[model samples]
Target chain A: PDPALDDAIRAVIDGKTKPLGALGRIETLAARLARLQGTTAPRMERCTLTIFAADHGIAAEGVSAFPQEVTVQMALNFLAGGAAANVFARTLGVQLRVVDAGMAEPVDHPALVQRRMGPGTANSAVAPAMSPETLAEALASGRALGADGDADACAFGEMGIANTSAATLVIHKLSGLPIATLTGRGTGLDDAGLSAKRAVLERAAARTGALPPEAALAEYGGFEIAMMAGAMIGAAQARRAVIVDGFIATAAAMAAQAIAPGCEAAFVFAHRSDEAGHAAALEHLGARPLLDLNLRLGEGTGALLAWPLLRAAAAMMTDMASFESAGVAGKT
Target chain B: PDPALDDAIRAVIDGKTKPLGALGRIETLAARLARLQGTTAPRMERCTLTIFAADHGIAAEGVSAFPQEVTVQMALNFLAGGAAANVFARTLGVQLRVVDAGMAEPVDHPALVQRRMGPGTANSAVAPAMSPETLAEALASGRALGADGDADACAFGEMGIANTSAATLVIHKLSGLPIATLTGRGTGLDDAGLSAKRAVLERAAARTGALPPEAALAEYGGFEIAMMAGAMIGAAQARRAVIVDGFIATAAAMAAQAIAPGCEAAFVFAHRSDEAGHAAALEHLGARPLLDLNLRLGEGTGALLAWPLLRAAAAMMTDMASFESAGVAGKT
Candidate 1:
């Protein structure tokens, strides 16, 4: 964090409010933003949601019961207004835009932003998957799309079958942690399937060279993860609140923070997902999620569930009557 | 729980919408109200929040670190707009009216409704708390106040130090459960305090006779709990959605349900509380709480936290485009 931003945040904390640190993380986030932007009253406007759609090469590994086609189907569901994400975004009054960074088929949705870097990468078990150029393009696409939204803040969500495997690989590579620590049964995988996922990830890591801050990302990262990382960096530069979803989004956020350390100031962990890896990711990010519903659907549902709390937090900051104004005595 | 109201709720579940049970408890509540009042739309308007304030005699038991005076002080703070509940009510655009059902000291806030039935109850450890006449008057006062609000829906909140013991006793009597099973460390009480609280409740129950339902309430209940029960019943007679808060409100709800079986149609359990007996109370009432944050700090904080989710559920019911309207195919 910048010293000036840190100072500004402390000043806001010391401001004449109801009580010092009564608002919890909401107050902390607001204060940090105040310092970052050099404004006492930092407002959240132009809220944008980036739904990255990709096809995990690991889906071809038979690790998922749901076929790879479910990825495209769900992405279409998102665009055609049938998915839970659609209902949630509608309720939150936030704009939703889809990105086809590496879907298996040719993108057709008019609403979806066609930012494909490849048809899909090779299976990570066999090789280093995506090339550096493809990775760079995916990152650039995320940055460009985030910029296009002119978003005050952005949330990172994904739709990709077998993507949890990809997320595991990314997390393991980034954190220098073993695959066993970060791996989980994605979408109800059995114990055997989990073991298979761990083995696949370990082999993929061996094939890939020294994790090049960004190189490991290209080798093991899904297009959606790379793009989300890019979007996070862009949103951070724009000084927007990056509301992160569950395990996959947290992994992307970790990668984003690695590339651009300043992005941590702009992120808020929306909820503690039921996914096992989620706790590790949140701990790694030093984030406190708003809700814990044991939810693991992973279609930005947890983030959307927490939108009301965010609204409440912001409302408290903006609407609550100060002690002086309400003619009430402060706690002694 | 009425046959007609149950049928109406069933009709709502069978309505032409998404899945048969997708909307969950929301559709049930709306439909039950429709049957009770014989209206299709079943609108919830003129929302009233009655915060019952009292001083717990248990404070004299050395159970609480804070004195009984804090209850009066906080009640005044609520009237003066210094409490968390005040900030929450203002933010949610709900009308909050405070009622001093039992306070040792008189508060001079002009906004506070002076409805004191007595100075305070005797400590429950020794004898019956309040006289039957006082309990009846408290109940009547609550009913009158609720009716005056013209509330299409009502929410019940309470403010009293160490009232958790009072609530625990109510829950034990109402649920016919053992005190040990329901007793919890109220407001960060130690294990020793909890055991002592259970002993106190058992001793109180042993002394108190099973007076008539209303008379029993008067004899054993606090002025605030009795008043809240009356308000809940009144709100039901007026065909309003009664959003019940945590443990204390649940205890009052149980009392209201006992008095007026039809009032069950008007009740909606807002959220599950962190209190040990809260779930038991909810189960006794067959109420499904919306949120379950391990929060035991009453003063309607749980209900306030759930207000946004309630709004979201309502918004989904009213605003989301149906499959036909959005021109989208439902998932097979």
Candidate 2:
């Protein structure tokens, strides 16, 4: 980000006809967008939400509340325009894309982007989630997908049973936070189910120690998570704003930030999730999301919901009249 | 609002293809719209943002940051589509209406609605802010304006100089909160300005121990505030959802609720403002706003920014598929 450009944007925002700083966080958001685009006025006219769907082998350990088949079902739901993501995307006029990264049984829809790395990742509780070759393929495929879109911003979502467990272990290894603190109810888990999931994640964490980011992904990350990380990096390379969804998408962003340290400059976190460990994860990244509606459903729904605020901020920069232009008196 | 219909809406929301309560506040918002409209599916397709502009008598006490003439200037700004409210209303497809409730100087724009009771109100710190006849005229005029729109939802905004002072005293009288606690820097006041404002409001509060709602409005309310209160009640009576804006608008809502006890059922608080005592005012009404962007720019901008979320919620009710229809398995 250019400090000079940021100062210029701030000056313009301050000259608006409202009280100094009365626009509040919206002023801050406008400045951030301007600095990212290196322009006085930025536009968020077109946005695309990419939902990466995969199955987690960790589901074999009974980690998620729903069975693994739900992943493919949701992928099909997205293609059929029947999911929450589809509804929100339609409401906001956002383009929606669903990708099948690696499901146990692939959905055969013409609209589904097939970028499968394997049937699914191996269960991390007993072994590494994926081979290094599979990890490389996933990252490369996601980079291509992210680079192909012409939208000004790209939002990422994930659909995988037991993926929250995968995200928790990945984050625990990356940040060294406690396993119990980072684990939570995935899709409405009962107390016993939550405890059991935490115990299983502990077993997965015990299998490795102090691994690099790549090794961490190969060991603990699901196919969709690794791909989303690479997609985020690629989107940043293309200079598009990376709008990260809820907790699982945050895990992908954490991985992306680790792999490409400067790519997080493109990230605009959408909301703080009700999921356990989300707040800690956000704190670790020094990120504050735009909305906090206790949203935990994650098919890029939260990211799509925040799209209007970005538009409003950009419009404020481009459309609002300055005090002098509006012939209004300034503060005494 | 029907209790049985609310239960039916809740059931419909739960049966959507996501987990129970996964959509967070959105689920609650959908149910609220449904209950308010007395339907399982409510639509927010058309919305109107009515900005009531007036000059507050409190400005004579030096309680505001700007001169009272800014009110007429902003009303012209709104008519010219150069203000933040105009931009947001355009972006959200909401109709924008500018009402000259009782500005000291009337704007000559062809689109301006002239509902002037007088050439402004009297100074409230020394005497009554408005005559009883003026208050009654303002309410009736606002009621007619609110009931005349063909919109599913109505949002209220105020653009009156020193109106925050008027709202502070009005809320203090109605809510019985301490005047000092309810006073704040309206539009970027320095510490000394804030102290001066608080002292003036305390003096106004001491003018009457405990007045009836109408008497208090005549003694301390602005024409814009009285009009907005009447507008909210009229919109509720017309079965249109009422979206209340920041500090001044909340004070109007408080008065509206006091005037008609059940009118608040149609109210949807838009955002928590950065202004002081806004949280206390919201608490007094038992309200939790949909957004919290620290926005203090009134002109209905905060309410307009929140319009997309309401649309998404309504779309979720009308569009999203149930698990049975999508053939997705339930939680195991």
Candidate 3:
């Protein structure tokens, strides 16, 4: 952390018209923005939301309510500017970038980033999900996306059917939380389907017991998850604010923290998910997300929702006149 | 709320690519916009924030950390567009109107909405705050502001130094909550200052116990508090989405609910205040604020912070292609 910048910005925020720390988390956000940008006048103007798309082989186990085809389709929707993330990003002027980390089928669109690691990862219930080479490729692709010079901040989202099951297993291994506690209604499963999902995920967790970071990525990580973890690392390294979305995104952030030491500094957890596992996941990371609107959609929608708060925090630091400048009296 | 429009708008929100209620509070906000506009295709293009500034007689009791003169000075700051509200409202394209509801000294500015009920209210610790006629005039003015035909929605905030004391007294009279629970650091009070303020408020509350809405307005309400409550009622009557700010604004909201029935339908609580009393105050209103940023600054900054969310919610309902149109598969 930039201690000098933190001290300078703290004085700036304190000298504002209102009470000390009266802006609450916004003051905290302002300090973080200053630390990340290495200046008190932090600008969050060229923000970007990058969605990594892939298929999870766990879908073959009937863990998701939607077909794996939905992954590519959602990516197409993002490219077509029809998803919730598109609406939110358009509102905040956040540039949208779609990366084809590893979809089952090849996608060729004007905006579709062609960085596929493979068709998809293998089912973790049966064997390790990805080869070491594929894991490295996905991580590199994410790193490339995260370091785009024009981007001052990045909102990382993913589109992969049955990826939540993969995330649950990965979190269970990484955080040592019980698989049952980490499981949730991915894509809105019913009682019977949830039971089936739990049974499958429990088996997958047992199969990939307590692997190291590389082996864990090779074991339970979907291509999009691995790529997102890489993107988080890349964003942090580039000193860009990393705005993570919902449950899957938080899991990816955890993975990124483990992969690249000291990368959590650039991160801002956007919102808490209604998914049962999300609160524990955020708590495990010792993160306090900006909003908790009960969002569970994956396309960086939560991060996009929180974009305004961050922008306002920076704006407050730069634009708002201090009590001395505005000639407003301090507390007697 | 228009039930027919509500049903149609729910269909529109549900038909989006995201899951049912996956957008959570945003879906609720979208439905509210549709209801307010009486159409599924609601527009939130022209938003307005009306900040009412007034002096409170409670300040004379030395209950506030700041002098009463700060109210008029902050009003001038708002007129000059140098305050936090100006910064946030400028960012969000929201029109700002600063109204001098009542202050001890006269303020002159081209942009100031000159509508003072009196120089200031009488000291509520010893006598009534405002005359019955003054209370009526303040409410009517607030109603007039709320019914501005050009504004699609209204964000009500206030800039009254020492108004938190007035608000605490009002809430104590209305909801009968313990005085200690509803009192908080107004503009940053030290330990001794807080203790002194509490003692003064307790005495003031003892002098005026269990007053009705009109009596409470006369006994405990500051001109700004009365006017804000009136604005809430006025906005709700005009079917405008009333975006309320932090602690004082929430207290005004409770006052509005007491005065006018069914106004809660058009109300949107902006964010939770870090004030100790604000959580219980919000709970009494049965309101779930859109954000929990812990903002205590009361220049409509919290409402402006939430403006993007409300606008995006409306935009999502209007601009985004439905799942049927996007050809995205729904949950099985």
TM-score of chain A of each: 0.92, 0.98, 0.98
- State the fnat of candidate 1 relative to the true structure: 0.07
Instruction: Assess the local accuracy of residue B28 in candidate 2 as a C-alpha lDDT between 0 and 100.
Output: 90
Q: Highest lDDT among the candidates is held by which one?
A: 2
In the order shown, the candidates' DockQ scores are 0.17, 0.85, 0.74
Task: Summing lDDT over every window of 10 consecutive residues in candidate 3 chain A, give the lowest-scoring window.
Answer: A206-215
| Candidate 2, A1-332: lDDT as tens digits | 56788789989999988999888888888887787788998888889999999988889999999988899888888999999999999999999999999999967788999999888889999999999999999999888888885888899889999899999998888888889889989799999999899889998899888988988999999999999999999998887888999989998999899988998888999999999989899999999998999999988899999888888888899998888898988776
- In model 2, what lDDT does residue B52 have? 92
Rank by TM-score (best first) = 2, 3, 1
| Residue B197 lDDT in candidate 1 | 72
From the highest DockQ down, the ranking of the candidates is: 2, 3, 1
lDDT of 1 by residue, A247-298 (tens): 8888889898999887788777877876668788788777878666565657
Local accuracy of candidate 2 as per-residue lDDT tens digits, B154-215: 99898999988998999999999888888999987889999999998998889888988988
Return the lDDT, model 3, position B229: 92
iRMS values for every prediction? 5.8, 0.8, 1.3
Model 1 chain A worst lDDT window (10 residues):
A14-23
Clash pairs for candidate 3: none
Top of the candidates by DockQ: 2
lDDT string, candidate 3, B156-190, tens digits: 88988788999898888888889999888888888
The residue pairs that clash in candidate 2, if any, are none
